[model samples]
Target: MARSLLAGHRLQHELESAVDIVSRASRMAREIQKRYCDATQTVGDATTLAKADASPVTIADLAVQALILGELHMLFPEDRFVAEETSSSVQDERMEGAIRTWLTQYSTRGVDERVRDSIDLGSDAGGCRGRIWVLDPVDGTKGFLRNQQFCIALALLVDGLAELGVLGCPNLSAAQEAERIASGYTEGIEGEKCLTIVNGTDGCVFFAARGAGAYMQSLTDRREQALPQQIHVNANTDPSWAVMAESVESGHSSHSLTGKMIRILGIRQRLGVDSQCKYGLLSRGEACVFLRFPRPGYVENIWDHAAGTVVLTEAGGRVTDALGGELDFSHGRKLPNVRGIVATNGHMHPAVLAAVKHVLAEDVTSG
Candidate 1:
């Protein structure tokens, strides 16, 4: 049965609002991204928006968190949000000014006061509670900085499970997607551009409501004229035939171990992108395997995984920690109990899980 949103509100209404807020957030982010990279824009301008050590990408992260969380506060009113950025994290005036500028368009509250109070609305720590929204307003800062594949992810968690999810990826190519689906490698995109019907940039959005099924649509389309397509995990039972997805950043996982697992399983054709775009790839049947084995002692953040988990889960994919345990979200902001994450199309899970275990056993023996 499909789940209703907060207070018996239809899931459809919440889904609609979530999609709109995320869509607009995507537009805002990509536009900020474009301007950040513009040749005409002075380095000083980007410097002004930097977080620490002059990383300009922090601007987009702060801006998106502020707007989306603020909008969520307005629409849902009574719900809670656990988000990445907060008003206190705005350490510099440049960060504060940039966030305030974006909030100005949507907020009637004074810029400074709105900036402080509004962003704080997202700082709630989650629990097994009434309704909690998990948001990663900017899922991959590295990808966003380079104009590569970054995603904006949001989900509503009720009773410790993600009931609704939306992912906005503004860099993946639709034409390349079709070509790559046909042949693992397509004729390269010259100048590196995606064939997307762009709103602000070439991108796509994937969403799901539990039991209702997962779907994808163009990043820019409005509901009235949108061409949403239902999606599912690919039916590839053989690990040797799998196309795997992983993080683009080498530091994000223990690649050496993952490579051993892939080699043992005879899997080929790994596609790595930043952020939850990996989940979007899987839910749309583009890739079948994803692994995240962060360095020891680092607890996985819930905001990073909740949205993708629901989209993939509804699309017939299975997500769990490296040990094949369920990802429990009832605890708090960090998934302290989870060692790492592994997601795959359901058919390949057992085989993949065995390979992961085999590799871990070897790691223990070697250590």
Candidate 2:
């Protein structure tokens, strides 16, 4: 029924169009990804590269945002876009120069005036009315800098809800297994392994519309012309056997608290990764749960989780705030009304969320 609804929705055509757009943007970003990671000379050696050279991530971020917004705007002139990068915040002339050369060399459609000019498309204050596009051009700068895991997240929202989502993971591969996640990645790049992860050269794309279910496909390789494979959350009813996916950076989520929650829930396995690709991981059954508890006073930007929500939910998973509140995407750019985030396969959500609530409540009471 959901698959049929994916085609029936008024926005289905737009969703279909986005698969190609996101795939192209993802490949373009991969070009910049190589340069960004190569700056470190050796992978995972953050000390080797100076902060001054770190602007390539920004270059990729801004350029990709522009490319997506530019092409989408031309196609849907009346649609508004709310993206992550803006001209006011772009103070790096060197980065601007970098994008000019980068886009000229790597962009599939070639560099155009409107691409850079569309940088401020983020200025629009989106709300729950009509159709709007939300995008995080480059979701994990750290992951990109390290050449590990990163994604280009884009979504189409109608009346404040994400109906279509496209997650372009330039590092994730379509060949995934939950066993590696359960035991721990011991074998690929930089010591910690991702047997199914792609290098900077090629990647995968995960996409879905609300009622259409989720799908994963290969990216950057034209000869394959591979058909997308439908995906689903794993049926891991026991929390003890569950594998959780979380942020690679402890700063983004409180790992100490996460440790407590997983321990309480009997989940022994965890795979720390960057960006919204965690959503893809869950949707494709590589991982069973995802949890994040931001520091107090922190609110998530819409672009951070918008695309991820649809991908996971459509794959028979569930998403809600820490207290199990439905995620609210109507209040412009930030999820001001929501706190934290929890995602799991439908069978695991109830147990995992119960544990999350108990641990958090205990922490609050102790504080």
**Which prediction has the highest TM-score against the true structure?**
2
lDDT tens digits, residue span 1-367, model 1: 1122222545777887787778777777787777674434343254234445443446677778888877778778999989877665677776677677776764443344466676677788898877999999889876676566688999998877788999977765432254332222212212222221122244677888888888777765554434567789999977655777777666777766777777778785666667998888888887889988878787898989999999999899999988899988888888877877899988889988998999989988998
Least well predicted 10-residue stretch by lDDT in candidate 2: 186-195
Q: Model 1 — which ten-residue stretch has the worst lDDT?
A: 189-198
Alpha-carbon runs more than 4 Å astray in model 2: 1-9, 39-57, 89-94, 105-111, 178-201
Taking the tens digit of each residue's C-alpha lDDT, what string does model 2 give over 1-367? 1233366776767876687778878888887667556645344232122334343345677778877887787778899999877764445565566656656655455456644577887677989998899999889877787777889999999899898899999877666662243223322223222222334345788888888788888885765644678899999877666777888776788777777777777776678888999999999887898999888888899999999999999999999998888887889999986767999987888888888889888988999
**Model 2 residue pairs with clashes:** none
Indicate the TM-score of model 1. Answer: 0.85
CA RMSD per model (angstroms): 5.4, 4.9
lDDT of 2: 0.76
Report how far residue 250 has shifted in candidate 1, in Å: 1.4
The superposed Cα distance between candidate 2 and the true structure at residue 64, in angstroms, equals 0.4
Q: Relative to the true structure, how large is the alpha-carbon lDDT of every model?
A: 0.74, 0.76
